[model samples]
Target: MANTTVPEVFATETPEATVEIDAGAGKHVEPMLWGLAPYQWVSISMLVLLLFAFFGAKVHKTIAGGLDGKIAAIKQQLDEAKQLRAEAEALRKEYADKIAGAEKDAEAMLENAQHEADAILEKAEADSKAMVERRKRMAEDKIAAAEREAVEDVRNRAALAATSASRKLIGEKHDAEADKALADKVIAGI
Candidate 1:
């Protein structure tokens, strides 16, 4: 087969060679370093510049829009805070009203309790006074009855003594009918 080489297909080949004949040149031989060519670097830089030009406007716009979005978010939060403050104020007012109502209710309850207590006390005092009056009337009636009984006893003792003395002096026995008549007359006169 014929010898094949890649140089046969190249349109152009530029090879650079350097030869050192002197012995005093550097003791170590430096190998050839491979790197990007000047033209490749320039082309890459040009491509990067084109890419930046093409998409830079959009990126700048996106960044500006993102900043505006952040500002809008902060404004929304501020509005929410204002709304929350208003709600809190409303709640506070409502709570204050409830507290006032509760206080009024408590005061009314206390007044009612005081009135009830006064009524009960008045009733108890009235009952006690009535009981005392009733007891005094009963005691007075009992005393009058006792005095009547004592007077009756005294009259009965005097009549008995008079009858006994008469019976002894006269030496006579009285019939039941006569004695009853006399006793009746004496009792009636007394």
Candidate 2:
């Protein structure tokens, strides 16, 4: 026999039914199925469906597990956020209580200062009143002393004037005629 080319041998080995064209309007591809009997085609389709069902169940299980993990993580994060919020609220309450205490202390201090100021004002008023009264007593005593001194001076001057007038009257009043008349009366009476 004559030596055959590679293309001729290949075309003769695979029959036209086993190598059908799968040409389309916009695609060019070789046939995927050989020229098989009806029973052989049915058997191959059933085997491919069984394989798809097995692998589909495995893919479903994997996707469900991943979704469950994501949900658990979200729940844990929400719990942590709640805890943080609780801590913040506690801190706010603590600070508010401290501020209230400080305000109370400040109010007490202000009240104490007001009482002290009132006491100081009252003391000062009492001291000033006492000083005024003492000054008044001193002025009255000085006036009384001056009046006594003036009365004593007036009495001494009056006594000196009366003694001078009596001495002058006695010197001017005795004489000779009064002596003769007084001798006659004196002889008769003896």
Top of the candidates by TM-score? 1
- Cand. 2 Cα-lDDT: 0.77
Q: What is the lDDT of residue 118 in candidate 1?
A: 100
- lDDT tens string, model 2, 1-190? 9887676334423454443445765543233345565567889899998988899888888888988999999999999999999999999999999999999999999999999999998998998898888888788778877777777767766766766666556446636676578888899899
**Would you list the C-alpha lDDT of every candidate in the order shown?**
0.83, 0.77
For model 1, the run of ten residues with the poorest summed lDDT: 11-20
Model 1, 125: alpha-carbon shift in Å?
Answer: 2.8
lDDT of 1 at 50: 92
TM-score, per-candidate, Cα-based: 0.57, 0.43
lDDT of 1 at 122: 100
Q: Which portions of model 2 miss their true places by more than 4 Å?
A: 1-15, 18-48, 123-190
- Per residue, candidate 1 scores C-alpha lDDT tens digits across 43-97 of 8899999999889988989999999999999999999999999999999999999
Show the lowest summed lDDT stretch of 10 residues, model 2.
8-17
